[model samples]
Target chain A: MKTLWSGSREGSLLRYRAMAFTVGTGLLLLVFVGIPIQIWGHSKAVVAVVGPIHGYLYLIYLAAAFDLARRERFPISRLFVMISAGLVPFVAFIIEHRIVASLRAEERSDATAS
Target chain B: MNRESDRQVRWVAPRALVAHLLVLCFVPGCLIAGWWQATVAMSGNGLSYLYAFEWPVFAIFSVVLWWNFLHDDPDEVGGRRLRELRRDESISGERAELRSPDFRTEDEDDELRAYNDYLAQLAQRDRAKGWRSR
Candidate 1:
């Protein structure tokens, strides 16, 4: 039977990393790029109008990170850190880098074991 | 894995694919269309117009993308088997085991044979009862 654990470890890890990167980058764009421009360049009206959308996107990013973590069996603490990184400016980039490094390490170990 | 066993195995359908596609198309479409309407009303302020419109769209798109991430494989067969096993264990107090090389295939064949036998016995009884009535 095809179980959840049946996929190639490297492939699954890569998928999770990609998802993390996608979400992290999206959040970065909202906080760094979207929010500042709305508050400074535009008006409070602009921020007000766009606020709901940002909230929704952040929620989605968290959900995606959670799903990937579960599928890959990543430690819950690490997953929480990764999810929280989106809340701070430029933290997503750092989290993304960490994810890539850990994933590479995982791949190397899996390769050695096989 | 053995090719024979792999062939017998079926992959459960990913339930999220359709919902993901719908969100992808609908969210972007709504954002773009909304921006177009706003621009038409405002009569083109250039940088402000693009900034005002695109950010919200991107934000909504990102949220939809994230929402798609929350998924768990629906326990299609697992739940059914758990229920059946629970019932069997309660009644028999011995773990039910099928005596077949391939349990699924063998069980299906056994069920069909039993059904056919039952139908044949019913037909025979009907014929015997008819003769008695006559």
Candidate 2:
């Protein structure tokens, strides 16, 4: 179609990366910083603030992952893994890194072939 | 994979079967929790009533996700049609069409299939035009 991607896929990739970074940071702070401070430091402050932020960021992460997965035609299982990656600490970072590297490689090959 | 072959594979695949079984169990668990909360709400518990609605929404969301997983097309992982739809909407300034429909109907899936077919036709025409111009 005349309007299809306007010959670009970079937009989705950029959006996905931004969301992944945000979610990953939020998750790390909640899991490592917030939880530890709440438990040992006897402070509810970190948990009180970080908990809701992490929850909301996770929801947005799910949406972002879904959008990217749809654009990339990711298999449902892969999509699930991408979505779940936001739930655990460090997983989002690893998955995002791999996704960026693989996509870049594919784009390079596509450009060469075309 | 084609629909029939996909279905056959899913049927034989242990992981798929396990996933489906988990979904079946999870849905009923959500429903039962909803029902329990609803009953508690009848006794005038305000928070329980809120939870009653939440549980069913969770169940519905799970079912929708499961259905999408089951029916997902292996070939469309490239999201070509989706990108086209977004681009067309952007150019036409017609974002309303992409918004959720106002009314749900039994034939919603059929309508979506028809829309995809239309998009595919437009894509094919565009490809032909591009070839001619080149």
Candidate 3:
């Protein structure tokens, strides 16, 4: 069976970091920036125009997050949290910060032990 | 262990990358085309079709990518090498020790023990087969 984080640990960690950043940023931009701008500045026509794009991007974000979670062997409970973060407005950023901090701590402890 | 050669290792095939890129390119292209159609021709149905198609296609694409990611090679290059070295040394030493004169009597004793074990195994298998046949 293939091992989780099959790439170099550093590479895997960096990928996870990037995944968290992009997914978090993408969700934030959609919920905070894109949705609000569409609601305030333009017609419902504008929401019609941009909503699908945001949805597609959000799907991509979730996929990236799931990939990172699987590679990291994240616990089932934490994985649920990570997955749910994208669905809620502004939660992605918060979860991103928390996950990154936890991952960094894990890496530090692993390094110290080895 | 060639470091340069190791650097060249890639889990993803070139064809798969191209396929993924095409899907990525097509999703945006379809979205853009749908938007233009909506603006110029006022085709709401066309826009709806684009929106409907986008999610399912993207969902499948994401699943495929994650499957590939999960099946990527293990990262045990150095550890595997060390394991092989240790295994070889242990096997060779065992062989050398087994060749000594004192080991001859032990080997005969082991062979007698193995004969008894084999008889026991055969009897167990026969009993299992008999039960199955019944």
On TM-score, the candidate that comes out on top is 2
Kindly report the fnat of each predicted structure, to 2 decimals: 0.00, 0.19, 0.12
Q: Estimate each model's TM-score.
A: 0.37, 0.56, 0.43
- Models sorted by TM-score, best on top: 2, 3, 1
Give the residue spans of candidate 3 off by over 4 A. Answer: A1-6, A32-42, B1-43, B57-134
Q: Report the number of backbone clashes for model 3.
A: 0
With candidate 2 superimposed using the best TM-score fit, by how many Å does residue B129's alpha carbon deviate from the native? 39
* Docking quality category of candidate 2 according to DockQ thresholds: incorrect
Taken in order, the candidates have interface RMSDs of 23.5, 12.0, 15.5
Candidate 1 residue lDDT tens string, A1-114: 233234565445554555556656665666667778877878555454444455556555665565556555554356657767777766766776776665554455446446
User: In model 1, which residue pairs have backbone atoms overlapping below 3 Å?
Assistant: A57-B63, A60-B66, A60-B67
Q: Please state the error at residue B108 of candidate 2 in Å.
A: 68
TM-score between candidate 1 and the true structure = 0.37
Candidate order by decreasing lDDT: 2, 3, 1
The local distance difference test score of model 2 is 0.67
Q: Which window of ten consecutive residues has the lowest lDDT sum in model 3 chain B?
A: B125-134
Candidate 1 stretches with Cα past 4 Å from truth are A1-26, A33-42, B1-134
Q: TM-score of chain B, per candidate? A: 0.29, 0.47, 0.25
Model 2, span B56-87: residue lDDT tens = 76677567667666666544644644443444
lDDT digits (tens) for residues B67-130 of candidate 1: 4233322253345334434443332332123323332244457677787567556544543431
What lDDT score belongs to each candidate, Candidate 1 first? 0.53, 0.67, 0.56
